[model samples]
Target: MRSPAAGVPDPTSAALWGLPLWLWVVLGGIGLFGVFQVYYWVGHRLGSRLYASRLGRRLGQDNIRRVENAVRRWGALAVYGCFWVPGLRHTLPWTAGVLRISYPWYVVASALGCLTWVPVTSFGLYSMIWGWLRLAARSPALAAGVAVVVVAAVAVLVLRRRRRRRREAERRPEDTLTTA
Candidate 1:
């Protein structure tokens, strides 16, 4: 069912077993880029740990300063990498100034990283799928296995962080709970 790496077989060329090739290509690109960006942007802008109001004020000034230093020293790669790194992605940019990673550089690196990841993911999918289909005459269980692994990994990360936060909260005295 999957198309080639470009996302779909070229509409102008390949006519296969289903919808017109042109429509699939156009829709596929829009779905991939548009939907992905919106999801990423929403997460970046308002995820609980990272929203400006939360981390910006809660951590006071010192931790923010360390973050600012990290940004300045490493630039956009640091910010872009944060997306996959969970804690940073949600909270870093809000206090990025405290970390001192320049906004301009952060934007450039984040955009490039986001842009490249999509095409690369799509292309890799195409290669894997094409190989699977050609070699097996029908794709096997590999893709399903990959999906399960990715989901399980993400779940483990989310649960681990939540557990750590809960344990830390429990250790704090009733009044000291205000600090983290």
Candidate 2:
């Protein structure tokens, strides 16, 4: 992908930033999802490495004990809230597991933290993505093509869902009105 060299006379970047607000929005979402997926994968790997299990070591056990207390006492909201906090997320899950923190609660709290992370940080990210996508808009036809493809795909999905629902309703027409 040998693109225009640095400081080259490229109009792409300018064009992208000049695109309509809506196109930037769509691209921004796509960019945000990509970034989050990368972050999630890295975070998981970092957690496992830093908080690796050792069949039975005192330090490991102590770390687990501390994690368990935090989770057992505060739950996932606490886990997730501290998710982005260095050292906490990595050790918390491992310790919680060892401490026998309820599996469901662990999942719930972690999910909450992930959910919280997005709204808290996505706005800033979306702006950055918008700027990047704006650069892509230098090629008008390419940008329009992308927009059309996305719209067409969404339309196809919606039509498919509606058709499936209609068929299911026809097959079970009697069930639809049986209120007794």
Candidate 3:
């Protein structure tokens, strides 16, 4: 699942069945672009209803206003950057649509954002997963031992933190003033 380049795994670059890396990248990128476009359209189409609905209320008007301001100030650049942020990824595209940003700008910015994101995620996943597999293959016991040590270290840190918190709580001074 790695690219021709050594030590770099690119799932999109990896051929499936009889496919090739370039094809995979192209198809995957297209698919990602389509998805973002759909997201933008949905926002455009249902902008008012979605924003006024219970779900929208839950998202908070203040937060929505902030995002709107960001889009107004930065325009397509905000949408482009939002492709990488989790909640914003969902919100920004729709916001762009709600605000009626130029369609051309939306397409270009969103496409460019997807171009950057899809490959990175695809390649990074492949590298990490395959790399771990290779390491485990080479040293199963060592891998297991390292995992155990990491878990033990985390547990020790948690327990120490709890103990410290308890000691601090016990040392807190009591309030001397009483309410009338």
Candidate 4:
């Protein structure tokens, strides 16, 4: 195999900011694991008072309750599964800590989650971005159209979700009053 030219990067190898892609993935996994530990400890320390904290208020009681239920039901498994989910990824770990799930199990599950999730997301996201960049280089107009379509789809989804939530909220008070 031929060596890359002086000062030139290898086209076949993925590198970012002078670091190999694998290194970045490893670092990212470690960072996420550390953050998850922090979240767990914070939740553990906060205990029952977590529900009254400013962050808790912002997260909303209903949402925290949902997370709490998931943690209670699934235990450490939920911590692993949360890595695949969007909002739950951030919330579930804290709930696990607050509920005082088995620490050894939590570590095992979280480590597995980091190991699987970071590489998949890192490589997948890198490929998507590079693919977009290549498309942009070849056809700027096509790239712009693709970007617009993605943005529009996300906006539409967000608006629909918001509308649905508003309708739910409107009905909640009436339902509560009737039940009372």
lDDT of each: 0.55, 0.55, 0.77, 0.86
Q: After superposition, how far is residue 123 of candidate 4 from its true place, in Å?
A: 0.3
lDDT of 3 by residue, 48-162 (tens): 6777766566555656888899999999999889977877987778778888888899999988988898778776776666676777788998777767887899999999978
Clash pairs detected, candidate 3? none
- Of the candidates numbered 1 and 3, which has the greater lDDT value? 3
lDDT of 2 by residue, 47-105 (tens): 43434434223234444556556767786555665567755745555555444545566
Q: Using TM-score as the measure, name the better of candidate 2 and candidate 3.
A: 3
- Ten contiguous residues minimizing lDDT sum, candidate 3: 170-179
Q: What lDDT tens digits, residue by residue, belong to model 1 across residues 10-40?
A: 4255443675654554455555444434434
Q: What is the lDDT of candidate 3?
A: 0.77
**Distance from true position, residue 76, model 3, in Å?**
0.3
Q: Report model 2's TM-score to 2 decimal places.
A: 0.35
What global local distance difference test value does model 4 have?
0.86
Question: What are the root-mean-square deviations of the candidates from the true structure over C-alphas?
Answer: 7.7, 16.8, 9.2, 5.0
Candidates in order, TM-scores: namely 0.45, 0.35, 0.67, 0.83
lDDT of 4 by residue, 59-169 (tens): 667778999999999999999999999989988998898999999999999999999999999988987887798789889999999999999999999999889777766
Candidate 2: stretches off by over 4 Å: 1-65, 125-180
